[model samples]
Target: MTPFQTLTGTAAPLLEKGKLMSNVDTDMIIPKQFLKTTTRTGLSKGLFHELKTRADGSENPDFVLNKPAYAKAGILIAGENFGCGSSREHAPWALLDQGITCVIAPSFADIFHNNCYKNGILPVRLPMDVCEQLAALAGGANHVFTVDLATQTLTTPDGVTHAFDVDPGRKSNLMAGLDEIGASLKVAGEISEFEHKRRLMTPWLEPAI
Candidate 1:
């Protein structure tokens, strides 16, 4: 997994709230062979087109990602209730697996948000107005920007800064690059020491070791 400190791009505004995954889940988003890519750059070429069409070659321009703005989006600043659809890990996996390290929106589906954390993607929540402003910003002439989940700040390429919020615990984990399993492992040595002490204190409590 990649370590993330900041991101800068001139791409699409995030798909807001519940509309995102639902609006774009059309083609299942990926295929087995494309998933085998060894790098992120070429991965975008295989993004959503994998399951979108039949042999006839017609296209679904209605998909959010197909829109000109979202085609190469890096930081997604969207609206509330984002990522609310299917429980497919493939969705978030495909996103991160496609070089998206930062996703900022008003809200995110619980499972989706968790998936972001584990996969090293930063999922942020801002107010609706903020998302709208970001949408406008994203429409400009190749506007560049960055979102830092650790500092809870958004930085435009012009150097403007906007403060945001994140759960304190979540902030710590992201900064340290620790997922749930990684967090638990931090105390393994202590737990082992305690169990050894317990055995010495009460041999009777230990079965026939």
Candidate 2:
């Protein structure tokens, strides 16, 4: 799998931000069965369709994505505020389970956004209008995109590019596959140093049994 170190898809594909998120609900991103995976991926088979009622293989006309503007959405151009719900890391997992490597919305719930990063999904924020245009594009049969994390870029299949913002530390964690605890352990020395100093300031500072 190509780790999207950098590239953009859909809207600015190169720089998608403040995406208007015209459609697509969080429930459609991942279904219940996928909640079982400890690792990401392999959730693709159950994605979208998990929530889509097909009593048979027939599409659920009432689904958000069934609407022309959101069909074939590879980059998930979504609503003003997205990823809102109980903190289910599985939500992002489900998004990753599908082929969606990146998501662009106006804003993301804190825990949900962090979960996306942990699972190798790059959740982006874009201005609302940008997302609207992309949703419009999804109306066509060939709606798709590419997100490149390395260069912090978003590129459309047509080759347009856009720049995005990310915390350097967080970006490094994603590039290096360091989870929060993993990254903190790499700085054990610094933590140790601080503890030593605190001990000096108060000899009895250590916690009692």
- Superposed by TM-score, candidate 2 places the C-alpha of residue 82 at a distance from the truth, in angstroms, of 2.0
Worst 10 residues of 2 by lDDT: 10-19
Predictions in order: lDDT? 0.66, 0.63
lDDT of 2 at 148: 67
Give lDDT for model 2. 0.63
lDDT of 1: 0.66
- Off-target runs (Cα >4 Å) in candidate 1 are 14-71, 201-209
> Which lDDT tens digits does candidate 2 get at residues 8-68?
3333221224334333444555656656777766766556664355788787765545555
Evaluate model 1: give its TM-score: 0.72
Q: Model 2 clash tally?
A: 31
TM-score per model over all chains: 0.72, 0.69
User: Once superposed on the true structure, which residue ranges of model 2 sit more than 4 Å away at CA?
Assistant: 1-4, 7-28, 31-46, 49-51, 55-74, 138-144
Pairs with backbone N, CA or C atoms under 3 Å apart (clashes), candidate 1: 16-79, 17-80, 17-81, 17-82, 18-81
